[model samples]
Target: MRLRVHTLLFWPHLVAGLLAGLIIGVMSFTGLALAFEHPILERADRETQQVAPPSPGTPRLPVDELIARVRAARPEAQPSAVTEYPDPTRAVTVSTGRTGGVYVNPYTGEVWDWGASGWRAFFHLMEDWHRWLGAQGDNRPVGKAITGASNALFFFLAVTGLYLWWPRKWTWRTLRPSIWFRRGLKGKARDWNWHNVTGFWLLPVLIVLTATGMVISYKGVSDLVFRLAGETPPTAGGPPPGPPIHVPVPPPGSAPLPLEALFVQARKQLPAWENITLRLSGGGAPRGNAPQAGPRPGGNEGKAEARKEGLAPSTFAIRETGGWPLFAATQVFVDPYTAQVLRKDAFADLPAGNRTRRWLRFLHTGEALGLTGQFVAALGCLGGLFLVWTGFCLSWRRFFPAKPGLVSSGDASTSE
Candidate 1:
C-alpha cells in the first residue's frame, strides 16, 4: 500500500513498533484491569462500618439522605462530591481524588483499604509507569514526556498496522497461509498468528482508544483537532491560581456556607439532579471560575421565544465551588443562580456533532453505555496485552536468533 511505502520502512515507526510496543502493552492491560477494579475491591474489603439500611426493596438512600450522612460523618473534611458507581453491589466511592487520603464506602459508609488491598494503587503505579516510566518526583517530569511520545508512536502504529494487515501477496491461497495460522508452525509462525489475528480482531476498538487517547494525552494533537473542527480555543477568564493548596482555616469572622443546608436547599431547587459535588472550603484557592455566559445558555429557565421576543436576560457567572478549567471528578461546579447542576458532558447527555467524536470518546474508553462498555473495553485491553506479548516474542525470535536445537515454527516440526 502507498502508506506502507511511506511509513513502515521509516526509522522511527519501525523502532517505535519494536520498542514502544511493550509500553502500549502495559497501558492496555492496566486500563483493562481497572475496568474490573470496582468489583474486585468490594470482594476483598471487610465490613469496617456498621450501617442501618432502608427496607430490602426500597431504593438506595436518596442522594439527599446520602449527602446528609456523609456531611454529618466527616464534618472536618469538606464534602466535595458524591459518585454513584454503576455497579450495584460495589460501595459508592466518595473520593477527594487526592492521592494521600481518598476513602471508599460500600453500603451506608465503611472505609476500604490503603495500599495492600490493591485498591487503585497498583493501577496507579502501572499508570505512572505506562505514562512516565516510573519517573521520580510527583510532578512526573519524565513520565509526561514519555506519555506524549508514546501517544505519537501509537498513532503511527495504527496507521502502519492497517498497511501491514493488508494482504500484499494478493492470491487467496498464498495470503490464506500467511494470515491464517498453518496447522502447526513452530516459533515465528505461532507468534505471527497471535500477533496478526489477535490484532485484527481488536483493531477497531484499539484504534478508537488510541486515537481518542492521543487527543487527550497530547496538547498539540488536541489543538489541531479543534482547529480542524473549526472550533476556537476556549479563553481563560481569571488569573489562575498557581498551585494546589489545602483548605485554610477561616479568619475570625469568615463564615463558611453550611454545606448540609446548601444540599437541602439545592434539592429543594433541582429535584431532578442525581448528584452534587462541592468545593472544599479552602484559602488561596479561588472558590470557583468566573461565569462564562451566553455561550453556555444553561442557567434559570424561562426565556422569551425569538419569534415572540419578551424574556428576562439570563445572568451568567461561574458556579460556586466549580473548581478549575478542566474538571475530572475533583469537583464539578453547580451554578449558584440557576441551581443548574453541572458536569453533564455532551456524550453522557445527548449526541453532539456529526462525527462520532463524542460517542467515540465514550467508545474509546468503552464507557459509552454505562458498565457494559467498560466491560467490552476491558476485554479489548486483555487482547491488547496478548498482542504485545506475541509481537515481542516474534520480534525477539527474529532478531536475537535461537539455537539450532530450538526448532523454528515456520517448519513442519513446529506444528507439533
Candidate 2:
C-alpha cells in the first residue's frame, strides 16, 4: 500500500526521525565507548592542595601545607576552591580555571590533565553537535527553535513507529521476528523484520528519552511545561547581586577549625544525604544567600572574593560568592561557620516546569541510570541507528526507487 500524506503526517515524521536518530545513535555509541575510560588525572594537579594525613600524632594535613604545595607548583595560577570527597580512593578535587586541575595521590602528588586524548576532544565536539548542532554564541533563541522543532519530530516518530510495529493479527510465523534465521546473504525481508520487531520492543524507552531530551534543548516547549506546573521563575536568567560589602574569611592555612570538622558537623545536622563532598573554598570568599549562575552560558557572574574550603580549590566548579555546591540532581548551599546546610534540595526541589528538567538532563548524559542504564541506553542508540539506516533506505526506495517498487509515495506534496 502507498503511504498517506495528510492523515498520518508520515513523511514529515520520517524525515525528522532520521535526523534525530542519527544524532542520538552516533552520540550515544561514542559516549558508551568513552565511559570505559577513567577521568583520573596523571600530573600534579595545580588546583587541589591535597596532602597526606599528618604524622601519627599530627592533625589532618594542614590546609596551609597543601596551599603551600599548590603555590609552589604553579605560582601563576589562581587557586580558587578547595574540596575533599570522603572517599579515600579519590584525592580531593579542585576548581581552578575553565578546565579541572585535579591533584590525586595526596601522599605521592600525581596529576593528569587532558593531554592529546583525541577521545576527550571528540567527546567535547560530540556534545556541542548534540546540543547546538555546531552553532555558537548567545543565539539561544535560534538554538531552542531548532531543537524544539526537532523534538516535536521525535515525539511524532516514536508514536507512529509504535503503531506501524503493532501487528493486527499474531501468528506463529509472524510471532518471531524474521531476522533470527540464517539469511547468510539472503533476502532483505528478514532484515526488515529484525529492524521492525526490535524497534517495537525498544519503542517505549526511546520515546520518553527522545522527548525529554528535546524538552531540555528547546525553551519554547519548555515554557509550556513551566506554565502548566507554575514552575517558571522570573529571575532565572540573571545572577544575584553580591553583598554590598564582602565579608572576608581567613586565608586557607590560617583557620584553626578545619573544614573537615565543619563538614562532619554539618552532615550530622542534615539528613537524607548520601554523603558530602568537602571542596576547597577558592576564589577566597564566603558563601552568601544570593542568586548565582552556572547551568548554561551567558548568565551574570557578579564579582566577589574567591571561596575558601578544605584544600586549595582546583578540581571542581566551585561557587565562590553565591549559589551552592553542585548537586547531582538539585542545588544546595551551606553555612561554613555553623556546619549548617542552606538551600538543601534534590530532584524534588525543582520547579514543576523544571522537575521534568532533571530527568531530561540525566537522559542527556545517560548518567541517569546505573550499569544497566548505560547498556540499555546504548541498545536504544543502536536501535535508533538501525531505524535511521533502514528507514532512510526504505524511504528512498519508497520515494525515488531505482526500480519499480511495491510501494509509491502518495504525492510530491507529502514531504516538506
Candidate 3:
C-alpha cells in the first residue's frame, strides 16, 4: 500500500515537475532579480537621489514657477503633475503626458532623468517576464492565463513534493538525508539529496509565493480569498464611498492654494511621509483612488453619482517610508483651495480587505518583511531553480538506469 501510494504520486510529480520547471525557473530567477530592484535603482542613480540642500536663506521655487520652468525646458511636453519628495535635497519628479517624465531640481529646475529607461525600465521588463513570460504586452489575459496555470501546477508540485520528502519512519536517521547535505555522494545521489534538502528547507516560502502568485493571477480565486476573510474584493464598478465632505468650487477669479503650500501643510499632518502625489482638484480622478484608468463598466455612472453627491475632490496620494510604498500610502483629500486636510485614510486604518489587497504586492515580492525577507525569497528562488535542474536529472537517470555499481545503494533501494 505504501509503495502503491508512492508510485501514484511519483508519476504526476515527475511529469509536472518536468513540464512546469522551465517556466517556473524563469519566473523564479526574474523574481529574484526584481527582489533587489529598489536598492539597485537607488545605487544606479545615487547622485540623482538627492541634491545639495539649498542655502537656508534661499526659498524653493514656487509651484507655478517650477511648472513654468518644466514647460520652458520641454516646450513640446505637457507637464501633468509633480512628485515632491519630503527630503528637500531630492529633486521633484515631474510626469509629462503618458510615457515620458523628468526629474527637476526644485531649487534650479534642472532635468535629471526622463522616460521609461534605466534601472527602473529594466525592472519593468523583468516584471513583464516574471508575470507574463514576456509573451504579451502589458499583461494580456492570455499570458496571465498561462502563468496562472503554471503557478497552480507548481503549487500542486510543492504539496506532492512535500509528501515525497516525508520519511516513512520519521526517524532522525531516516530523515537526515532529506534534511541535510550528504558528503561523498556522487552523480544522482548528490543531486537527489541536494534537491530534497533544499526543497524541504524552502517548502513554506515556495508555497506562500505560489499561493500569492495564484491570487494575483486569478480573479475568482482572489475574490474567494477576500470572501473567506469576510471582506469584499475591490470590483471595477465604481469609486468607493468616501466621507461625505462637500467640495466647493473656488470663487470666480480666486486662485487655488499654491501646490507648495498644500504640500507644506500636508507635511505637517503626516510628518513621516516621504513622498506626495497631488492631483489638482476637479480632475478626472485622484491618482490613488482608482487603481486603473480607461473607462470601466459603470465608470461614467459612478462619476455622475460622485458629482451628484459633491465628492469632487478625492484628493492627494501621500506615501510614507515605513512599509512597502503600496501598503504605506495614505489618501488625503484636501480642500484644494484652502489646503485644509478634509479626510485621511492611512494604511493602518484601512479595512481588512483593503489592507490585504495593499499587502499583496509586498507579499508577492517578499518585501513585506524588509531586506531579510528579500534575501530569503531570493534564496528560495535559487533553491527552486536547483530543484528543477536536479529533479530533471534524477528523472532522466531513473528512466535510463546507470551501468552496474554507478548508482548509489540508497537510490538503488528506492528503485525497487
lDDT of each: 0.49, 0.47, 0.69
* TM-score of every candidate: 0.63, 0.65, 0.85
Predicted candidate 3 versus true structure: per-residue lDDT over 255-358, tens digit per residue? 55666777677677677776776543223123223212111111111233335634454355666766444346666666656777766766665556555654
CA shift at 78, candidate 3, in angstroms? Answer: 5.0
Residue 265 of model 1: what lDDT? Answer: 42
In model 2, the Cα lDDT at residue 313 comes to 16
User: How many backbone clashes does every candidate have?
Assistant: 9, 36, 0
Stretches of candidate 2 above 4 Å error? Answer: 1-7, 17-58, 63-68, 75-81, 104-119, 134-148, 170-191, 233-275, 278-282, 287-332, 336-356, 400-416
Who wins the lDDT comparison?
A: 3
Candidate 3, residue 21: Cα displacement in angstroms equals: 1.1
RMSD of each: 9.7, 8.3, 4.4
Looking at model 1, which ten-residue stretch has the lowest summed lDDT? 293-302
C-alpha positional error of residue 97 in candidate 1 after TM-score superposition, expressed in Å: 4.7
Worst 10 residues of 3 by lDDT: 292-301
Return the TM-score for candidate 1, rounded to 2 decimals: 0.63
Candidate 1 whole-model C-alpha lDDT, 0 to 1: 0.49
Q: What's the ranking of the predictions by TM-score, best on top?
A: 3, 2, 1
